[model samples]
Target: MKKITFLLVVFLALFSCQKTDSEETNPLLNAVLYMQQSAEYKALTLQIYNNAAIHLERALADKNWTAATEQNGDYQNLPPAVILDVDETVLDNSAYEAQLINSGRSYTSESFAAWCKEARAGIVPGALKFCTAARKKGVTIFYVTNRGNAQKEDTRKNLRRLGFPLEKEIETILPRTDSSDKGKRRAEIAKRFRILLLIGDNAGDCFSGFTHASQVKRDSLVRVYQSHWGSKWIILPNPSYGDWESALFDYNYKLPQSEKLKIKRSRLVE
Candidate 1:
């Protein structure tokens, strides 16, 4: 019995040591993971959306105001609308992100489609209140997302299930088709509605130039539009994933994991 007890202790100690080593060697401590798992992230999201609600009220009353820089002649004559990005903005997809981390896998279209088919995404904090307020004020809500059209049905179902205002014709949900850049789609929407505000987690959602910009270019663009940020564009916190990550490695999706990790580490200021 003593011999068996001694062996069991040895096994447990070895297993614990291996587990700690694995964690220390793993380089998947992404910002998205931290953002998704932290209570502070939830609080910040709620704060941003609550602030958006306040700004939405102000934007609606300002007839001369327009959020879309693409808006051209006679834009003020059109109905008021707000352009919003779907993922990580209005809808929370941290579960899908978490699944990738927990499973020790990267994001794949097949997995993403499977996750969307479940239609289980939850509404972001204060999103319902902000959208509901906009709806009540007769403002149109247009969701422009990079999610392909193949996921449109599931996306719509998920949004509707969460009590979001959805048009019966489903014209409001615009998914990516030929390109991921949303500037063209925003232009199309600008032709009809006077976009009051643009809300998203990515800088690309607001400006096409930021779509594939380098880290330095992105910083420059942000400086250029510094004034428009809080007034016309409400950006949510999405440290989990976005163009920012892609910019780190120069948007090279094919790079090996180790190479990407090296580049990411090299860019650190500290």
Candidate 2:
């Protein structure tokens, strides 16, 4: 946590004399700091995972209890599995965001891809314990991530190093092969395994129709499926970045930083 804050301080100090406008406007600085430094962030993640543990037991006892909206047919007879989004849910990649801040740049595919390939991400708070306990109870763990297929091995290695369960006989790491939306992948998993829980940091991780949706629409969808939250679906705090952030900018990745910040500020309330 100190490391994250130190990086930001050094970045700002390095430019204190020159002080370019861009240097003063890194939006990710505080978010990354909170993710790294705050006891509240750690507490929230631990609380969510602790809730997930309770729900997992309930789902196991009641065979009819399935988390995925994608689950259908006679899934009770199938093997049980928990589907989790990789980044921010199980893995903490705030270091990568810190790197972006230090470099005075926004996220780019190339930079993120390189970071993933490094396989140096720390596990999210309580993720290792939750996943290990779930695996011990004979629930198969499936990582349904949007990371590109090219990074699959590195992701698997990272998870393995962190003591997360990985089935040798089963290909559990499902990375993005076609589209970024994960609905199809979840549906495919549902066909084979009774999904006991859907855990992630993004709304899109648990349900479809959230990608690229407007802020109001996303909030409405949350209400539309209000019952599922903390029951069938568990969400981790990820204010640092997600579709929630993109929705503020209307999913316009090409928008200038100033424009994006303008849109975000306009949405704020007293």
Candidate 3:
């Protein structure tokens, strides 16, 4: 009887330990883990949007200016427009991130689509205000996102529900159809309007060669466009996930979570 009781106690203790470890084993935790939970993130987002507002005014005054480096000088006479990434740039999907963390699940398209269908995403700190100001200035707002075209209606519903300005007769939201690289989409918009500024959390949103580039190549490309960082290309903070994380893993998505984590830790400078 004593031996039986001892074995039961050992089992209970082991179960308790396993439960605790499982609860704490989320690999998504990092310095930016509390970004949505912290005040600093809000402030930084506000600052970036405010700066964008100021730059937009300046760009409007200079009809000859085009934020898109790929755009030729002839496009200066076209109507003004701003290209923005929907996720993490204009929309606060931190709730989705929180859900992933709480559920101990990595991001999946189905889950993200379900979240979009719910349309519960809130506006980023100053996104609405900046976008509103840009619209009032008669500048068209183009949302060029990598979200699959299958999610188009839900994404539109979410953006419209959040009171984002959308074009009346023309579709301004461009979703991923064939490629993840947005250079072609940007060019398509550039042909119609003079792009004033490009805003996003990922470098790929603002420039080419950043989509699947290595860490070294990405850094080199950033340096190559050193002058465009703050002026024409406004980047929001998104440390949770992006091409930045993908670069750490050599853009290989097939790696197991454990291997990806190992690779990430190995790449850390500290």
Which predicted model would earn the best TM-score?
A: 3
What's the true lDDT of residue 9 in model 1? 100
Q: Which sections of candidate 2 miss by over 4 Å?
A: 1-24
Give each model a TM-score: 0.91, 0.91, 0.93
Q: Pick the candidate with the highest lDDT.
A: 2
> lDDT of all the models against the reference?
0.87, 0.92, 0.89
How many pairs of residues in model 1 come into backbone collision? 1
Query: Local error of candidate 2 at 197, Å?
Result: 0.6
In candidate 2, position 245 carries an lDDT of: 94
Task: Give one digit per residue, the lDDT tens place, for model 2 in 137-245.
Answer: 9999999999999899999989988899999898999999778898999999999999999999999999887877889999999999999999898999998999999
For residues 68-176, write the lDDT of model 3, one tens digit per residue: 8678858868999999999999988888888888887888889998898888788889999999889999999999999888888888999999899998888999999
Compute the lDDT of residue 56 as modeled in candidate 3: 92
Which ten contiguous residues of candidate 3 have the minimum total lDDT? 25-34
User: Which ranking of candidates, highest TM-score first?
Assistant: 3, 2, 1
Which candidate model has the greater TM-score, 2 or 3? 3
Give the distance in Å from residue 178's predicted Cα in candidate 2 to where it truly belongs: 1.6
